[model samples]
Every structure is written in structure tokens, then in C-alpha cells.
Target chain A: MTTKRSITVTVNGQQHQTEVEPRMLLVHYLREVLDLTGTHIGCNTSQCGACVVMLNGEAIKSCTVLAVQADGGEVLTIEGLAPEGGLHPIQEGFWEKHGLQCGFCTPGMIMASYQLLKNNPHPTETEIRRGLEGNICRCTGYQNIVKAVQDASERMSTSAETPVPAGD
Target chain B: MSVPAAFDYHPATSVDEAIALLQQYGDEAKLLAGGHSLIPAMKLRLSQPEHLIDIGKISSLSYIREEQDHIVIGGLTTYVQIEQSDLLRKHFPLLPEATSMVGDQQVRNRGTIGGSIAHSDPAADLPGVVLALKAEIVVQGPQGKRTIPADDFFVDTFTTALAPDEILIEFRLPKATGSTGSAYDKLANKASHYAIAGCAAVITRGQDGSCSAASIAITGATVRTIRARAVENALVGKQLSETVIAEAVSHATDGEDMIVDIHGSEEYRRKMAAVVARRAIMRALERI
Candidate 1:
């Protein structure tokens, strides 16, 4: 048996120090060790984007990445998208646009979309489709999910020009 | 699913350190790059190495630069980098176009170019593109650094010319010359993430609007990406016309066994290869 290794990872802005088996995946580390279960494991294989998370500001499928691979990386989960009392524009767009039917793929879908918009804030419809292509939503037929990204893009653009009121 | 087996993890900071680890563990050690390919295989018990030499952290092997006669891309450069690189887009548009269509956003973020070539999966999109571009794979071993032409680098399905202790460090794509253009098209399987059939076409148009030189490669229709010599022979010195392009497409899969799987049948994939080859050639011709 191989010995576990001690590593430090920064997740959602908090430093997490732990000793884990060499084989532990980042998805398992987030769910089991840190108790951030928002990242679901739908396919365990990298095929399903259900385990997507932002490692060092880039969206990656956590299941394919070893926890040790993320030792010195900064990670962001769905829980970190919005800090207090409110949803991010993407989350709000999903709620308003009805982007989810089962909610299992929401965290990953949103995380992938988050990275997309972060990199290309104003993507065309075809570009948006390609951007979210990695993320799969078995429900809602992806029509509303595409609409949500459009809605979120508009909201994010509008918010950038005029900041949202602090308390509402 | 749990990983197949427990393995010792060694984080190598430099290429020398990685080589030493590989030499120490021998065939028992496997280099871990982005882990987009190996980890999934390990999870499915397709591969079970006793030691994982983690070379993903070696920062030196991650770069994309333009050289005098070629584009030097570090093997560890991720798909996301290729997709976003303005340097690659300006000189090698085919690379970014193909990289954008790879597994998906998250997969592109973690999958490295080096790992993809090293994996040498027949259905992989980049291998065909690299072969069409006539790229070279640079490897470092205990002996020294050597360059393997892309055609020679890919020997068979899921295999390369890399030895146990040899590490692929970079790929060198010959610079385009004289109204040159390239493109890649693939019919990807939604379930398996492998291309059902893919084609990459690179053409150089002469002053007379005729083909100066053309290189065509097809993947997923065979055990490995192979140069469509028949197509190239038909295309060279011919006018960039629909008739010639059609003839070239017919010869796209001349001497290969098409892969038949859940995604597509042998006949369908063969036909798709012809179609994709024609489209890629036309797209490349238009750019030229």
C-alpha cells in the first residue's frame, strides 16, 4: 500500500490542509474530506461534467484530477459562486430561465458556464453552445439552459455597467 | 468509481528529476500529465502502473512559441491554451479550431497536447491534424533529445514511439509557406468522446491558383492516422476545383480498416471520412 500524502489546497478561499491517499480524486476530496458536496459525481468518468469545478480559475472535471494534482492550486466550487444572501447572475438566470429539472447537473453546468463567461464575457449563441457543450443536462432539453446563459450574459453585462443595489 | 490500484506518487520538479524517477521505477512508472486520459483508463482498469511520476507540475514543459521555421509547443500545453493562444491562431488556425472541438470545455482545460500524442488513440483529433501539419515530436531520454516525425511518432492504436524512460517534451509544427492553409473536421461520438471519423487537410496554393503541395490525413477510420498519399497525389498541381476535390475525397480512406463501434458502422465512418476530408480540403482551400 502506498502512504498518504499531506497537502494544502485552497478551496473557496479557505485553506484546507489534509492527508489523503494517493489515489483520492479531487471530487472525493471536496465531497468527503471538505464536506463540500455541492459538486456531485454523476458519471465518475470525465464524460459527465457533474464533477466540474474551477481549479486555479479554470473549469476542470474534478473526477479526472487527483487531489494531489490540486495540492497547490486554488479551487472554487458552486458554494463559492455567491458569498452571502444572494445568487450569482448565472444562478439567478438559471432560476429565472428554468435551467434545471433535476438539479444534479446544475453545479457543474453553472461552474462550466461561469468559466466560459469569465473568459468570453460576450460570446455569440453558437459560441455559447460550444462553450456549454462539455456540460450535459439530461433534463430541460438544454433550450432553457442556453437561454439561461444568454440571460446571465445580459444580467452580467447590465450589472457591470450599473452595480446592483447592496441590500436587495 | 475508485481508482484501480494504489500507486506511489512522485512529484518531479524538473525534467531531469522526472527522468530519474522513470529510470528508477522503469516500466512500473507511468508519467502523469493532465490525467484526462490515463486516470480514466486507470479507473476502468485498462492500465495499472505501480508508480505515477507526476510530471504535470513541471512548469517548464508548458509553452507555445513561434520559432524561425516552426511553431514550438511544449508537450504539456493544455488544449485550453491552444484554443486561446493568439500565436497559434494567427499561424496555425487549424490547431485552435480542432482544439476548440475537443472533449469539451472542462476536458480541454485539463487535457494536454503531449498527453494526447503520447496516448496515440486512433480516434484522437489532434494526431490527424499534427500529421497533416507534418509536425515533429521532441523526446528526451537518458541518451539525449531526439525528434520523431509525426508520421513515425504514431506507430499504432494507443501507442507511440516513446520508450519507457523517454519523455515527450514538445511538438514542432513547420511554419506555413506561400498562401498555405489548413483545417480539421471531425464527427465526434457524443458518448465515447472519440471521433467517429476525422480529417485534416493542409494545402499550399501556387500563384496560378493551383495546388502547390497538399497533405491530407484521416483518423478514426484506421488503427492510426495515415497520410492519404492517394489523395495527395491526386491533389498536387491540380486546380483547386470541385471535381479534383471530389476525386481526392474518394481516395481518402484508400488503404485502411475503418473502426466500427457503438457510435458508427464501418461503412458510415468510411463515408464520413470522405465527407469530412472534402469539407476540410475546401475550407483550407478557401483560406488559401
Candidate 2:
């Protein structure tokens, strides 16, 4: 018999202290435990980026991370990107630029782009393509996705007074 | 959803504590560093140890500092950290260059230097880089701490010299002296981004414009990472030109078992290894 470990993870801005199975993955903990299903699990083999999330301010695939491994760590999922109702700038870009055809890869794509634009405010088209190389959108050939990121970069870079970082 | 088999998770905060846990669990325990490589295997039910001593939070075991004549890097330093480090860029330029090409952005954020090297994955890039730089691996067990040369550390694919009770602590890389240059080249498999053929070269030039010292190591193409001593011997004391480097790197797969996987064939990889080795050597030469 295996014992359950108690872990506390700060997701978005809310604190959730829960008991989980030792083998439970972070994505499972989010979806099944905390009910944050924004982070998807496409391949489960770590090849696809559908499970990407911001763990301690760095992007990592949630399926590859154990719930116990993320003990005391801060996680920012797609659910936490904006307040309850409205969309974040990157999400707005996707909606405005038609970045998604089926929207399966949007959450992971947005979370990844959130980090990329945070790190490099003004990313070139090549940089955007490189930044999103891990994500796969089977519906769109990614021409519009690149435009969506470019659209977000301009929106975030221009709108801020005194240059407040987009994702901070 | 694939899940790991039920196992006890022991989070150790110190090296001594982790070593004690290892002694307690014996062969049933496996140290979980970044959990990138091990987790996937566990999910596939390939590596189901009875216990996992979590050592990722051993805060002291993650750093990159210089002590005397050597550059000391702790085992848990992430590839992204190594890629952005100014100290490594100033002292060891090849580390940053090699790290930037390791994996995609998310993979690099979690995979650790010590974890990748200890796993000894044939497709992993850092193994060949460490072997090329001739770094020393530091390991600690219940008995005491010991250092092993990079040449001897990686015994075979998915294997290392570390016993079940010993944990990799850090790597001690000798600071390159004089005008030294190093590079890594590979033909990456598209989906996994792993090398079908990878070569890493470190060369130091003498004041006479000849090769003073050379260390070349290969991965992905072979069953294990092996030192290309014949290629190294051919370059020393010779003025390295395109023709000489081409001739020297021709012995890249002289005596080795080439890996044949779905990603590539033995014949294809053997041919790619030579071309990749020449490119790596030529790039190193250009940097000098």
C-alpha cells in the first residue's frame, strides 16, 4: 500500500492545500483535484506541449511533473492568466487574429507565449516561431498563430504606460 | 493517462540526508533530480523503483561558481540557467552554445545538468559535451565522496558509474587555458529533437599555430558516448586545416557499435557522424 502526501500549491492567486496520491501528476492534480482543466494532456509522452504551465515563473509540461515534486511551488495555469471573466492580452490576440481553428492548443500556446513575451517583450517573427516550436496546432498551419503572437507583442508593448511587463 | 506505479516519495533537503535515505532504501531507491527523464520512464512502467528520494530541493547543490583553477557547477543547474549564465559564457562559451540547442524552451527549463548526465541517455546532448570537455563527475555515497573522469563516468547507454546508493553531486570542469575553442554539432530527430548523430570537439592551439591538445567525443550514433582518441591523436602537433580536420574526423566511428533505431539506420548515422564531427571540428577551429 502507498501513502498519500499532502501538498500545498498556490495556483493563480488562490492557495489549495490537498492530499494526493504519490503517483499523481500535476496536471491531474489540477484537473481532477482542483478542477482547473485548462492545461490539457495531448500526448502524455512529453513530446507535445499541451500540458505546459508556468511553474515558479518558468514554463514546464505539467504531465511530466509529479504533484509532490511541485510541493510549495507556485503554478500559473491558463485559468489563472486573467481574472474570472475577461481574456488576457495574448488570449485577445488569438481571438482577434484567429490563432485557433479547433482551440485545442490555445491554452498551452497562450501560457508558452505568455512566458516568451514576458522574457522578450518585442519578439521577432522568427523568435515567435522558435518560442512556440514546442506547441502543435493541428488545425492551423501556424501562419495565423505567428500573426497572433505578433499582434499580442505589439498590443502589449504599445499599450503599457512606462512599460509595465505584460505577464508580470 | 499513464501513471507511475505506487512508490514512497521521500523528499530530502540535504545531501547527507539524501545519502542516508539511499542507504536505508538500498537498491530500491532512486534519486529524483528534475524528474524529466525518470518520470516519463516511470509513466511507461519502465523504471518503477520502490522509493524515490527527491533531491531537487537540495538548494546548495544548484550553482555555477569558480574556485581556483576550475569551474564548479552543481548537479541541479538547469539547461536554461546554463544557457543564460554570464560566467559560463565568459569562461566556457561552448556550454552556452550547446545548452541553447539542447531541447525546446519548456524541456530546457526543467532538465538539469546532473540529471541528464547521470541518466546517460544516448540522445541527451550534455553527455557528449562533458566528455568532450573532459570534466570530472563528483559523486557521494555513504562511505565518502569520490570523483570520476568523464571518460569513465558514462559506461554505456542509460548507465553510469554511480551505484544505487551514490548520488551525483557536481561537475568540476578545468578552466581552459590559452586560446581554446569548442563546439557541438548534430543532426536532430524532428519529433524528439534528439540527435541522430552528434559530435562535440574541444581543441587548444599552441603558440606555433598547431594543435596543442584535442578531445573529441561522440553520441547518438554509437551505443554509448566514446572518446575519439584516434581523431584526437591525428590532430595534435599538426596545423589544423579543412583537409587535415576532414582526414582526422574520418576515424570518428573507427571501433564502435552504431545504434540503429527507427530515427536512423546504422549506415546513415555512421555517415552523419563523420560529417558532424568535421563540422564540429571546423567550428571549433574557426572559434580559435
TM-score of chain A of each: 0.93, 0.93
Give fnat for candidate 1.
0.88
Give the candidate number with the greatest TM-score.
2
Query: lDDT per residue, candidate 1, B62-136, as tens digits?
Result: 999988999999999999899999998888888999988889888998899999989988988899989999999
lDDT of 2 by residue, A30-142 (tens): 99998898899998977778899999888999999999998998899998887778777888899999999888888999989988998998999999999988888888559
Which 10-residue window of candidate 2 chain B scores lowest in summed lDDT? B91-100
CA deviation > 4 Å runs, candidate 1: A160-168
Q: What is the lDDT of candidate 2?
A: 0.89
True contacts kept of each: 0.88, 0.86
Q: Candidate 1, which CAPRI tier?
A: medium
